[model samples]
Target chain A: MADGLRVGVVGATGQVGAVMRKLLAEREFPIAELRYFASARSAGSKLPWRDTEITIEDASTADPSGLDIALFSAGGSTSKAQAPRFAAAGVTVIDNSSAFRMDPDVPLVVSEVNPEAVKEARKGIIANPNCTTIAAMPVLKPLHDEAGLVRLVASTYQAVSGSGLAGVDELAGQVRAAAEHASLLTHDGAAIDFPKPEKYVRPIAFNVLPMAGSIVDDGEFETDEEKKFRNESRKILSIPGLAVSCTCVRVPVFSGHSVSVNAEFERPLSVERATELLTHAPGVELSEEPTPLQAAGNDPSYVGRIRVDPGVEGGRGLALFLSNDNLRKGAALNAIQIAELVAQQL
Target chain B: MADGLRVGVVGATGQVGAVMRKLLAEREFPIAELRYFASARSAGSKLPWRDTEITIEDASTADPSGLDIALFSAGGSTSKAQAPRFAAAGVTVIDNSSAFRMDPDVPLVVSEVNPEAVKEARKGIIANPNCTTIAAMPVLKPLHDEAGLVRLVASTYQAVSGSGLAGVDELAGQVRAAAEHASLLTHDGAAIDFPKPEKYVRPIAFNVLPMAGSIVDDGEFETDEEKKFRNESRKILSIPGLAVSCTCVRVPVFSGHSVSVNAEFERPLSVERATELLTHAPGVELSEEPTPLQAAGNDPSYVGRIRVDPGVEGGRGLALFLSNDNLRKGAALNAIQIAELVAQQL
Candidate 1:
């Protein structure tokens, strides 16, 4: 216990930050001292840690020199501003935002897929892949190792929690307002009045919006979430030229994010062999039928419905579905795992 | 009005059958006389048609000698048992079931895509495509015609109504049971006690189920709904050798079914040209962001999010999304449109 490390959590009041705090305690991470930090608005508040309350520090103004590691789950802007400052103070930062993921010096690491890459973080900052991308890494890494994966067509069913607490609130409010009108929705979906949507472009209660993130105005018509899936997959898998077409959609589910992937490999990959590989794959489990409800609050990415994609000639294609808790394995747990890797190196 | 043809609707007490009756009146389908038929249990019941109550007749025992056309929205077994009987009695039968869709003697028709195929119904029975397949037909028809589509990868966000009234009841019951536990669900989805699911394998209220229909025993790991999309799309588009991979997922929405399609063509198809074609295509409308709520009770298939697939070489692939009313354009309205074509010939 005396050899334990001192750790700090940035944006400790946010949704993913809260999950990080819970998981650190649940997993019994080696911690000699724990600290919480948020914006100035939440700085003076106290958060409970191991039967004691710790005063929150303002991340923008606080000194992080004494901390061995800091997990950042604040938005991109906060990470862009505070990550380097904390890192320069000798605190290794495992950031869960997109701000530093694409930086060449800052390795984008999935703890299971690329934990060794943590040593390559010359900037003293390791970037955790996007939650949607993180869910697919553990599932795709094993497949890519067996057969050279060439092309991928992925369609996602994302949950509201990916957008944080506000998304949760919007979906909950709409569901409460419209649950009694389920009969009316069965006949005419638009007949009832839903509270005007604030977090999403459409109602997220009993509906699905194909646009998950705001579209990038580069005339490509791909959302940022879709782009992240393609970019982060290639970087983590070390397949620089991987062909990917991704459609990210927001569904009514609250916690889990699922993806239906049709992958074309360079070599012939049979369903049986793929299933066997996935059966033994780390951080993955095989299910008969994978649903978001089964994955919520779970650690492993549940994968199932493996089949040969007939669309690809010579049986070189495999189609499968996977679901994972967006908050657990997707964000906080992965960041914590990266921190663990850094701890080992230190 | 005097020259109008006599029409009959089978399974008039069912969900799609109710939509059939409503559309028949809304479209003013030149019905000189209207008749209703269902199973023996509903045979003696009364249904309204044009302000007049019509007593339902037993579909198994009814004589159809005088009716010019009969629309069947019953289950597959009912269609197989009664469609041939009605057709043998000189009534053209348009079936909304999977019973005869792959039958060579029966033409699988999507009214907007291949209305001329109506003449090839050699058995006097025309089959409407599955609701999930129907949602993509109008959106894909023009692009295929322009680019000679060769391969397709589709992932569906299907509504509960596609599963019939029981599915609707299961989802509604679960939503009503779990709506108040939204906060709990946002953190731990499985913590809430949802009603035991009957129509679906998993709770469908706030979850997405990857297995939409039961898996076919052919060892392909494909659901009947997924197989239907591949088989029906090939037949309707007249590309018998087209390669297709489809994943059918049931969402929480009630009425509209949506598909994300990545289509590869023999010739390069530009996003601009595909958008232009879809803009003018019959039974298709272009929207900025298409959702199920917007497509419910609508006649056209709403399409948007057109992009060039970076995975396909030479700009030969395009990606798009579409939504349509699963009950209307997918089942009931399509059957009625086929009836209209048969009426023209009669």
Candidate 2:
């Protein structure tokens, strides 16, 4: 414990927060002292750390002092109100919410793609990219380096777990209720009476919804998740003017987010070269047929189905598919990885 | 009955064949007589026509002397072996297989997109576009007419039924077997013992497989389904030089295929205009957020989530998502519609 740091896990009772707690121990993060913080409803409850239980503190009233780092997985509003206060208390905040990602003073980071950006966190807050965006960053970084990436068209097959625990419950409930009507569902999907959808606009079991998030009223009819993919990718890749078009869709799977990307670069990129680069790229594993199931409990982004995008001239375009665990690499694991980088500096 | 034509339905005992028989009665096609044909195994099986049962004939040995039009939903090899024989007997063949889709003489037709191309079937065979490709044709045709479409980047969320009844059975079996393991599947997808995959390379329950079909040995790593999307779209839209890049993925849904498209055109097209064009386009319907479940057992291609592709210059690009019944508008309905067109000409 001699050179270890004290850490706090905010939103400690949530889905992503549970993953954070598990990873912190699995990776053997150098923690001298650990604390858990949640909402008032869950405060004072005990959560296991390793061999002992830690009492959950109410995030609103708890003193975040003495903590060297705090990982916030609560919703955006909670982060908006609490992150700055923790940062002011001399703790570096690694936020998994969308609250401060677009803030210029805060660096949005995917640990493998832009670890150096950690040093640019002038506000003492590092933001993790959205799960869908994070899944593609590790795979696209090497390709972008080989060729000057100019444009990207991405379509996502996101899992229900990305919406948190409510999403998991919705899908599970629907499947349990509708699984017996396989014959009806096979022929007429709408004929089945699914449990009323609450987490999403439609039933998530045995179905694919093209709308993953609420539509932003920005006149573009684009979902917030789609905007996050474009904005976060541009910020992390350090290409402010990068052209992007994304469609975010939610599938019935419980975890792992998959993206199908068609990228055009200023310079020509061959399929063989892209394959070679991804084969050795950090945090990326080449798969023959990448699926959300194969990536649900994995850390690396499993990427495959690489081919030339016949749409772009001079072989300047390539198409690929990739999947990564939305909870681990997309959120908890990356936040902890950033914590590791921050610990070295401390 | 005097103006009605004699029709023969090849592969009349399979999945799409079942749909064709139902639709023929529903749409009230002008048929003087109807004959059923299938493989030798199912040859003598009796299928219900309007008010009577029709005995299935072995397609390989069937005599097509009396039929004026033959709709072939049989596999490519079966069509390759028997379609020409049917055509030689003075029957105009509307093939749902890929045997003659790319052939110079056989005009690949999507009813709403290029009905005029039906006259160019010099080999007496009009090919139905692939189910995945047919879903996008009506949606893209109206847009292309408004804006000279140049390039398309498509990522598909295809249903398992596209592979045939075997796909539906595989998904149903896995879901039924794994439904009780929802907790384990939600946490770790690979932890469950899903039924062995037969139609696909991975478990289709609670999973999204990026590879939809067998990979062609075309050195591009593109699946036959992906290639069909590119080739059939070009032929149906009559754009010989259209640049298309498609990633065909199979999801757990039983029916209906969905596509997310980012299209670049020669002219600038606004979202409002694109929406208006699609609203009035034949065989098309506009929904707020289209899902595959909504399109199942439906006729029109349900399209929504229309937006400007910020990637292309001067609003020359548009991004949209669409869903259509793969068995209806994609296969059976279109082939029957072509038969109606031929009946009118006769």
Candidate 3:
């Protein structure tokens, strides 16, 4: 597979990092060597990547002189401080956090949506779009290319994992509470217990919460996640000034993210044309049967139920649903994809 | 309390009926007498209302003659055929299905939205709006009264019980299938054997199914559930041509039906004002923190996350969320309230 590439994973002990390592191994990336980098809390531990155990270095104190590339899944703060240092050493940083996405100098991407943007990653920090936006872009961009996206009204069913380990813990606790006793609230019958809310602001067991991120600036422009959807779409599709309004919520489901998108187009978009286009679109899987669980652990963005928006007349506008693995396409897989492209260019 | 009323419950053994019976007992409806009716399969089965025992009659065969009022949670076929007979026998019928909801002669009522509609049940059928519609109606109607509803876009996360016990079983079975290790298609996860396919069309475990009923009329307005969301909203809200487009999904959630709605009004409606209105609106409980589990067995149509629709300008519109016990205000509680209104008019 050409010359094998040397790879380094940042935030190696975190959820997205673990997934990144797994995907790299599963996809059989031709790795000549592998290394991991984490915070001091996880220094010296080794991760199994393609049959080799790689030592993890601490970002603050460890040297990165030999690494060819470093993938960062740590939160925004860590990425802000460490990404540049690694890049200064001539290592490309494929960052999974939101740290550099909005910077005009740094390109935000979904591999299939805007792989071309990678060349413009002058800052060395290539940003991954928010998971919710990533799941939708692969499907919508192609359609929008055909029928300009004039405006959109969307809602999302985001899985707990979007928040990481804490999210998964919250749901397990809430569902247990639902099983144990009847809630005075409504009627799921016996409530089961998981834990008191140590993570999310509210109990998520046997329940769904609409509060994704704190109300975005008086609940105006967008929730933090919602804005990611709008601005990220603009950047990825290379279409600025696109009007996108979205409502994103977190549900009890453990892994995939699902969105119901209503797009009003400048021209008309018939179901026939849209479906035919999506049928062959890269990174888009036409599921005539899209659902959150069916999307769990899979890579392709699942699209289904194409119909007229009725809100917008004709074949001119339409609505559909999307679900995809937030951890993979949403984070790790996309990072690996960028690294793959960089390995070629370097 | 107003000379205790005699009540009969049709489909008493079904999911909504069971909930209806529980609500009747829980709310302590002023019942001097109570009777249970079901399809032939459940005939002779016992239903315990309070400390008393009542045997369910075969709704298809048993006459509706001896009741003061009958609550029909039975399916539409039963409602269409039997409601008239019950009304002819001097029993008012509060139907929980779509059979008569759009019928001009039948008053579509949600106690809080249109208790007055009960006075207009001339054809003897007091129709209940579909569950998803009812959950949002009580909250939306008040907002509509203040600001004319221009358009509405909604996505629902409905529980299994909306389909009945078999639905709950289907979801339960799918969860267990994970332990057994089976591919999604061959697993047939719906538990009750009766829970399997030929019913839901696809698996329901850990997933969300976008379309709820069969694709009717080539899917322009497919699914019996979708039609009800459209048709029922029109009749109940007095908007003959309301812009109601929806994606009704069945989630792994067991009870409440949660909706994410983006509603536009002729005049501007702020999220704060909607919250204020909902707090005092009849039949609506203002949830400081609204969630599906918390609103489960409760009676209120809880509304929260009121915010202006960023998609629209003019400060005239808002988008919010709702989670209500589909069995309560969406089904039983509403039916009972309609029955209450009919008794008063009589």
Candidate 4:
């Protein structure tokens, strides 16, 4: 840890924030000094970092003078408000929010897929692609290189944790209620005294919500999460013309996000070749049947159930499934990995 | 009710069998005499149909003499052995098992989609399509009729109840344990004390199992459920040339199976046109965001989130989501509805 850099973690008390801190330590991310920041309500709270404790500062008022790098996992508004300010203060911001992601100046980087893109961050800020997109990058990058990937249809099985701590609590509470009334729920779903949904539009326990994100009012009729998948995948894969139709669904899983992808390419791609590519791909692991449980708390995006999609003409399409820990590889770990890449340059 | 028919429900003690009995009474199928039949283990058990108790007869050796219609919700082997015997005895069998679905002789029917096909049951066996296939027929029949569907890519969120009572028990048991150790599961999926899975490959309490059916050794590497989605969709839709790629996932929900379908047609089908068609389609209720909870115990296949799939050329592809009660519409209800059709003919 000789070249440890001073780092500040914004939103230190949030769900992804907790994982961010853990990865920083677990991955032995070089750190000389650490500072934690949260909203005003959580200011002055203490968070442990290895041998010592750090007092949390309200992100709105925190001074960014001495920090070399700051990770913002707070929400979009916080990144929109504070990221530029930190950049002005000479701190590189690797924002985990959607704020700077689509910005022309900021680079949306997936460490393995587009690490070199980090050097082009003109605004001194890098955006972490959405978790769903990040999970796809490692798997798609390898495939796209082999076949000229043209179109994709993705249906996701997203976890409750992607909605943050409240989503987790809602699912936990509902599960408890449903479990208690197991006999009732088995025959009749309405009889399970499900708690009134607070965080989601419907009960998140033992249910699959077809609508994951808030429906974007735009006439396109896609959820904001769905839009992010299209936009982010295009930017990260550098395939601006790539067409995607995605249905983002929230499942009862705790952490991992699984995607069933059917990709159509310009050229024919066999299951055998795709398997070979994914087998040696960075940040991806091939499994027989990848599930959330198998991917949770793990680093690699597990890919499996590879088959030829006969729907596309002349065997040009391939259908496969993938699972990745939304919290780790999807969010915190990827951001930390980007920070690590930035750290080396510093 | 006019034209009351004598009905015998094979596998009357099973999960789907229970639903069949309830639906028979609920729908007032004009039953002059209701008889129950199950395997020898449950032969003597009594189940209440309407105002009186009906004893379950042994399916293997039970006399099929006087029964006009028999609904078989038992496993495939039972349906294979008993369906023929009943059919030979002049009783029409609406078999819910996969035994005769692919048989060219058996008319595989979804009551709303292909009621006319019921007249072609020359073998005296009308096969009810798989639960997942039944949910898609109503939604697809309208679209296919309009645009001439050529291809389909389906990703399913099937409830545990689709697996039977044991699946429900496994999920209920796991949820109980997960709720007891909520904190452990929320943070670490591996930390949860999940019971050894008997009905499923992995824990199904709060997780999604991508592999719904056992992988068939046909080298296609697709699960039996996946194969059913392909074969049944082709047969029921009567689009023998239709190409299908499906990933069937078992979710934690006690009832209601949801499907995310991306379909390509020979002609252009706009979102508005698709929505309009689904609005008045039989056995389908168009919801803004269809979920398993909302569709549970409901007969209609809840369809929503209709969108244009830009993946296909010439504006030919459409994407949509649908949910239906796996036990009702997917299993028992369809059989009952087919039985009603048969009753009308009788």
Candidate 3 global Cα RMSD = 3.5
The chain A TM-scores for the candidates, taken one by one, are 0.98, 0.98, 0.94, 0.98
DockQ of 1: 0.80
Proportion of native contacts in model 3?
Answer: 0.43
lDDT of each: 0.90, 0.91, 0.79, 0.90
- Provide the TM-score for each candidate, comma-separated: 0.98, 0.98, 0.93, 0.98
lDDT of 2 by residue, B17-67 (tens): 999999999998888889999999998989999889999999999899979
Tens digit of per-residue lDDT, candidate 1, span B234-312 = 9999999999999899999988999999999999999999989999999999998889889998989999989988989
All DockQ scores = 0.80, 0.80, 0.40, 0.78
Task: Give Cα distance to truth, residue A184, candidate 3, Å.
Answer: 13
Between prediction 1 and prediction 3, which has the larger lDDT?
Answer: 1
Candidate 4's C-alpha runs over 4 A off are: B1-3
lDDT of 3 by residue, A228-323 (tens): 888888888877877777888887677789999888888888988999999999999988778766777788999998888776665567879999
| True contact recovery of candidate 4 | 0.74
Interface Cα RMSD in Å, per prediction: 1.2, 1.2, 4.9, 1.1
Q: Which candidate, 1 or 3, would have the higher DockQ against the true structure?
A: 1
**For model 1 chain B, where is the 10-residue window of minimal lDDT?**
B179-188
